[model samples]
Target: MMDTWLTNGKDEGADGGSPTVFIVDDDCSVRTALDCLLRSVGVRVRSFGSPDEFLKSKIPDEVPGCIVLDVRFPGQSGFHLQNEINRMEFPIPIVFLTGYADTRMTVKAMKAGAIDFLNKPFREEDMLDAIAQAINCHRARLSTAKNVKRVRARYDLLTPREREVFAYVATGMLNKQIAEELDISEYTVKIHRKNAMEKMEAANIVDLIRQATTLGLAVHAAQPEGMANGTANGASNRDKPSSAVSNGTEYDCTFE
Candidate 1:
């Protein structure tokens, strides 16, 4: 997908986030008209006369924006730019504006993750609507990215010992069973368990379990040195991790 970006517009959308729109068109008149139109709607506008010119300028990663790109260029095509953007880290949306419309080009842009493909003579209302939708998509993507970063920060607070305890607890092992598995006292297991819950900011065992599964710690819990799987004993493997009862679809995250 084209997880690329372009933007700075006036904060006009009801959703209340700064979204910029970058317009890349070779025709000076087309760029001027689009710049004025988008600015009037409170979208921050930057226009470029060529894809090469836009590429030469720096776009910040923090700005959540979209591009209004002309599909056909003098030499370097918009599709080439889209491909380059796909390799970048940021998530930005793209909407193609073209006068030379065709079935093959439309399908190619859409398949490469463009938000919309509009003909050159497109109406002003339709263009605005498309830009607004692109901004919202960028916002949602940014929010999700923030959530993942926050979740990982919390996970990083755990100690290796706490992490081990977290894994056993996530798999639904009791204090006594975990004690035997790790060759530690039941009291020590309880201490580790309590510390793990606190470090993870988990409200309870279930919450901790969801975080473990979402962060994929439940899988890695087995790999630490001196930690044996149920292959060493039966009580650990008798049942599943018991995280299925949780409706934690919102806690989707992965610590790489």
Candidate 2:
């Protein structure tokens, strides 16, 4: 788990919420030059002389950013640092900077998900271009993570009966079919479905399905005739999202 001192107890940027470029290199000259160049273009930056220092210091995970990591260090290699950061909950994209270049090293880094690999004496244009691409990707990843969290929160807000109706309806069950399976009236099924849709903030059936997919909720495939004959059981656990909160019984969380 990374520390959080940079946040100063606020979500918005400790660095003005701007995308940052983190520089980790042993050479003082290298770190200073890169900082000046990046700051000149209105980019946020933080520099460290070694991998341990970088890992020890806190960075605001919410900041959209990339790392410019030196490929070779005295004790810990850049690859080692890369692997460590990749295991983090919110890993920053890495743009590798190496004074020495080789085909095998380049392939390995790219395979491990580095955004860019630049040889020493790299052009300013190339460096800036790589950093831009990395920041764009990191921003997109953060957006997706936020969306999933929001969907999960809404799912947790649903009543148990509403969640059951949601699973069935999302898989294309009619209110009548859902009512039959759950031992409720079609009118009641309709009510639950309506409430589920509202709580999930879905615009329509299509939108509702998308949100269900995002939730990773278990939904049996639609089989209307079999379901009417009471052949199908409840949803299976094969694809359930780990974060979803569920009750043991259908009426466990129903409200008056």
Q: Pick by TM-score: which candidate is best? A: 2
Q: lDDT per residue, candidate 1, 1-256, as tens digits? A: 1112223433332245466789999988889999888767566788888878877998866566889999988867999888877666555678899999999999998877788999988899878877777776765556655555555677678787766677778876778987897899999989989988887788977788667765655432444354455534433333433323222223221111
Instruction: Please give, for residues 165-233, the per-residue lDDT of candidate 2 as tens digits.
Output: 898877666688778889999999988999999999999988888888767665445455545533447
The per-residue C-alpha lDDT of model 1 at residue 123 equals 92
Model 1 ranges with Cα > 4 A deviation: 1-17, 171-185, 205-210, 213-256
Give TM-scores for every candidate, taking all chains together and pairing residue i with residue i: 0.72, 0.77
* lDDT: worst 10-residue window of model 1: 247-256
Worst 10 residues of 2 by lDDT: 247-256
- Indicate the TM-score of model 2: 0.77
Error of 1 at 81 (Å): 1.2
